[model samples]
Target: NKARMSAAGIVGFALEAAPRTTRAQSMDVLSSQANIAGYKAVLVAAHHYQRFMPMLMTAAGTVKAARVLILGAGVAGLQAIATAKRLGAVIEASDVRPAVKEQIESLGGKFLDVPFVTDEEREIAQGVGGYARPMPPDWMRRQAELVHERAKAADIVITTALIPGRQAPVLLKEETVKAMKPGSVVVDLAAAQGGNCPLTVADEVVERHGVTLIGHTNLAGMVAADASALYARNVLDFLKLIIDKEGKLAIDMKDDIVAACLMTKSREPELTS
Candidate 1:
């Protein structure tokens, strides 16, 4: 696809090209869409879940608050934590990046700490480019053990772990789904990329071992209006990087964002202006 575009003398910009930094944050389409997806994931899970999210006390009986487990503490995961908390759910989240522990706590979600025993594990857990790098096999095994235990107690689980351009990590195994309580819901935001839960089917809601697995690839599309608004703003902000003050289309290759977004390896003559 890139070769075809370059062969046709077309200069293209990647919408998700902006680095996750304070200066270029407004132009980050990934973050914008993820924010909406995270918010929607909780709502979707609540809709499918038979039990109440918040606890209630009455003369007849008292209901316990739902336990929600979130895998991944990126933009989507953090937003999911906040949304679930608002509905009075007890949220616990896990991520390879230890840096997100504070963010999860700030949003009223408990951080599931997977201790790094080895120096190599600790270095890899730091991740790269604001995204999680694939952890060592030993570390992943440890995380899986922890997640399995947590999933059994959770009424709702949302998995958002994904490594860019790679298959999504499998956090929740098949056994974990089977161990979850009856009528539990698992929302896999990483469904498009094979999912964090092995049971998830992309764009389908399936029932396995009495657990509902929501594998909607495009959660942002579920709340289309707001998602579109946010995306359009991101596009507009990105346009400013390529358009000059005089209203002329100016592609400045020197600009960090512009350079990062350039898809064609070779510069196109038409874009030189």
Candidate 2:
């Protein structure tokens, strides 16, 4: 298609475009979709779990609030924390990056601090371009140990950990799932790229060791109306960078976003008045 476009003197750009450093975040399609996915993941977990999300006081008895553990403190994970907090769940979140600790607390969720013991571990934990890189095996081992204990106590677990162009990191092991209380729910948002939980079956809701695993890959698609609206706005924002005030197609290589998105340019150039 790119070759055909070039032959036809039509310029083309990548839809999923980002420079090393982004200037305008509003034009980020991935973040927009992820925001919706995060909000919906909590709702999905709430729907599956048999018990109530919030504690209830009644003449019959007192029901305890659900305990939610969120893996990954990215855009999706942070939104999940906010949504769960609004639903009155006791939320605990873990992430490779220590920077997200404040963001987690600001949303009324507890940050499960996994201290970096080694200097190398601390440097890698900083991550790249606002995305988490794969942690060292030793760090992963420690995280898994902490997650195991936490999962046992959690009524609902949502795993959103993923690395770009790589398989999603496994935060929840099969043993941890087995240890969890019966009727607990695990929502794996990284199902498409393997899962944060090893037991997850992509796009399928399954039961393992009395725990419900939701491996839905497209949580944003579940709420299509809002997702589409947000995506459309991202596209609109991106278009403004390439189009001039007089509605002329102005390809500015100086603009980081425009340069980054330029997948193909016309070889047989066509002049526009």
TM-scores of the candidates are 0.96, 0.93
The prediction achieving the highest TM-score against the true structure is: 1
lDDT of 1 by residue, 1-273 (tens): 988988887777897867777888988999999999999999999999998999999898999999999999999999999999999999999999999999999999999999999999989989888899999998899999999999999999999998999999899999888889999999999999999888999999999999999999999999999999999999999999888899977888787888888787445444552
lDDT of 2 by residue, 224-246 (tens): 99999998998898889888899
Instruction: For candidate 2, give the lDDT of residue 15.
Output: 58
lDDT of 1 at 38: 97
How far residue 268's Cα lies from its native spot in candidate 1, in Å, is 5.5
Q: What would the TM-score be for candidate 2 when compared with the true structure?
A: 0.93
Candidate 2 residue pairs that clash: none
Off by over 4 Å in 2: 1-10, 20-22, 268-273
